[model samples]
Target: MSHLLELFRFCPVCGSEKFVENNKQSKRCNSCGFINYINPKAAVVAIITNSEGDILVCKRAKDPARGTLDMPGGFTDLNETAEEAVIREVKEETGLTVTATRYLFSLPNTYKYSGLNVPTMDLFFECDVQEISNLTARDDVAEAWFMPRKEIDPEHFGLASIRKGISRIVGK
Candidate 1:
């Protein structure tokens, strides 16, 4: 009951008030012996760059880091591969289609959504775009622009995972 998920008071299966901590990551319904696990979510990020190697960046229009710099990407849908998710999210948010991918690295991030701290495994990929003239800002993006390699300061990005990724890119 001391967990942050204090709103989870009753058993989901039998409406019993006997749900107890089974482990660090799960709760158990003592009545039905049903256990629910809180697992880290899967997310993807597109590290897209133009012909001059200027990275594509987005300004967030939503909370958690509104107006801060970000890359083109989002959480993966159920049963979606990381590759597919990168393609879909980039198209939805940046209007750019991904033609190729170069795996970069993975980082663990804590995404604050709706006051709940959600743990996520963020998969970063360097995406290839055939055309850049057709790209535009949409979805949760306030604006989209290309940042030159020298100007891509990690401190400008609000997400810790993104900062780490950029630091790695800049050999920090």
Candidate 2:
């Protein structure tokens, strides 16, 4: 969780290691009046299914899961709503524009990556693509294609959040 060190740290005000948990779910420095809060991170994922029920999957080009098939999604930026983040991430990775049809579900997941514990709150949405064409992969994506639900392999997926999202859709 060293990566978390940048986000979580000793309160500058109080030198005491002992801290109190605040009602708002934050740690208050005991010595000095400093508060440390764990901010919730938003990750938006797209469950893109066509009229035939085929879903879009992308091969990840970066670590966590390089060369693995997963849904197109990413972290939501500040000031951007979850819906907007889903649409933007899908377009950025798959070159397809989609309309968020409905909210699917949210999942809390954690994993160790690069020696850091990454905790994420994933917000998923079922979306409809406006058009289907030959998708050119972006920097973070190696390739994109529509795969049948039965053909997905959970073991080759990038993250648990993605695997769980697909499981909810396919009832696996």
Candidate 3:
């Protein structure tokens, strides 16, 4: 939350040079009286399990946790539902189509990117892949693989929300 205030020097609504912080949640424009609130972004997190109960994981290729373990999901685009976002992200990163999904949970997380702490609400879903075999990593993923649930280690995940989500998903 502190990151949002620090990044904005002027009011976005009125372009006024004078902007005042009303609280940790919002900023007020002195010129136009436009109030801006810091809202967490919506992101989808996949908990893909195979017939053998192994979990699909992606090796991140970007920062804020590059080279670390992540699920096959990403931020939602405009006008896309959470379910649609998960399906699209899964296909984009893993080259697998999502046949179905079940909502599991949501976790709040902070992603630091380019010197900004981006707040995100990670909406988790148990995604069903049409074909587990012959999967390839793409987009921001460098590699993709599956591991037994028993061998899953949340500590290996780079994001705090991912760690917690893995723990909850694997019953650890």
Candidate 4:
């Protein structure tokens, strides 16, 4: 929030230069009384598993965690539901079409991108994929593969939320 306060010097609503911190999560414009609330973004993650119980993981191609393992998912787009986002992200990153999604859990995350720490609520789902045999890495993923649960290491995942998610699954 300190960074956000530093970044936003002008009021977005009135174009006033008197924007000031109103609270921990918001800023207020002295000229127009407009309050800007900083909210966490919505993201989705798919817990894809093969029939043998191996978990699907992707190698991140870009930074903030490049070259590390991640689940197949990303931020939800405008006007899109979390379920739709999960399915779309899975297809975009792993070339696997999600036929169904079952909500599993959620975790708070801070994604550092372009020098900004973006807060996010990561929604997790167990997804059933179609044509699982046709897996190919795409988009921000450099590689995608399934690994046995026993061989999974949470420490190998770059993101904190992903590591926690992996721990939860491996502990199960």
Candidate 5:
């Protein structure tokens, strides 16, 4: 979030935060003629399904959709493969060990947060849980559960990627 960056006065070009917004989009460093362009972050998540054909969803513990249900996924780490990120996110959020079967689809969505454009390229994967027990929420997740596709409320879901993933899987 840009607000998080505002706490610093170092120029991004020279680690100096003495900068000001030129108009409404670009930032200019007073010390140096350095201009930094803000960009969006990418996040990856899984649409995990059990043998019973129920899709896994977690209650978000953070904003953008706090308390809303979403698939177990988040920002992809540096140097981490999409598959690795999905598997790790699923386990971290739901406490369920899973193996990624395949990538479902990639969705690009944008939302505003902290006065900055938060755009995300959400990479969705279809995964199968190895063992369903020992479930507890972690990684900014309040709760996790499996729900039949037909029973999921669209309005309660955090993003369209989640809804689209469920629709695609259940339709097959």
Candidate 6:
């Protein structure tokens, strides 16, 4: 895995090549005394279930893990709350307008993107959508469907945190 510190050849604040590792989690610009912390990005995961107790699942249309089972979610945008992000992500990926969300739990994950292993804190939420009648896959989802909780196999989910979450929810 490529270290995030290695990616920073220059300091953002001073545009100096003196940016070096300040510690395990940050890079410091010796020229201007600017330190950039390598913090995990915040992401939201929506666990939506149908009235019949089937779980909503999406097929990833893009890689990191394309053609695999996933939940509707994405990284939170700047200046947005986690709740808002979940609602937005659900709509963008599943065409479902989330009416309510209850925070569940969070897990650490390593998302490989652009040849870099980006760390993320994935927050899980139990979301209620307005309706599933119009649940068409959109955005980065190739397809979306609901499976009975008993039929869900955690191993089918490519992401580690998601697999764990599904296991916990299904008691599998």
Q: TM-scores across all candidates?
A: 0.93, 0.81, 0.96, 0.96, 0.75, 0.95
The sequence of per-residue lDDT tens digits that candidate 5 reaches over residues 30-130 is: 88888765565678877766677787778889887789888788887999888888788878887888854587677777655775456678787778878
Candidate number with the higher TM-score (1 or 3): 3
Better of 3 and 6 by TM-score: 3
Candidate with the larger lDDT of 2 and 4: 4
Give the least accurate 10-residue stretch of model 1, judged by summed lDDT. 1-10
lDDT of each: 0.88, 0.78, 0.90, 0.92, 0.74, 0.93
lDDT of 6 by residue, 1-172 (tens): 4457687799999899999888877899999999999899999999999989999999999997899999999999999999999999999999999999999999999899886778899999999999999999999999999999999999999899999988988899
lDDT per residue, candidate 3, 63-139, as tens digits?
Answer: 87999999889899999999999999999998999999999999999888778788899999998878988689999
- Best candidate, lDDT-wise? 6
Predicted structure 6, TM vs. truth: 0.95
Model 6: residues >4 Å from true position, as ranges? none
| Candidate with better lDDT, 3 vs 4 | 4
Higher-TM-score candidate of 4 and 5: 4
Q: What is the lDDT of residue 68 in candidate 1?
A: 93
Residue 74, candidate 3: alpha-carbon lDDT? 88
**Candidate 2: RMSD to truth:** 3.5
lDDT of 6: 0.93
Candidate 1's residue-wise lDDT over 5-98, tens digit each?
5567788889889998888777899899988777889999999888888889999988788889888888999999999999999999989989
Cα RMSD for candidate 6?
A: 1.2
Worst 10-residue lDDT window for candidate 3 reads: 1-10
Record all residue pairs in model 4 with backbone atoms less than 3 Å apart, i.e. clashing.
none
| Candidate 3, residue 102: lDDT | 96
Model 2: residues >4 Å from true position, as ranges?
1-9, 12-27, 111-115
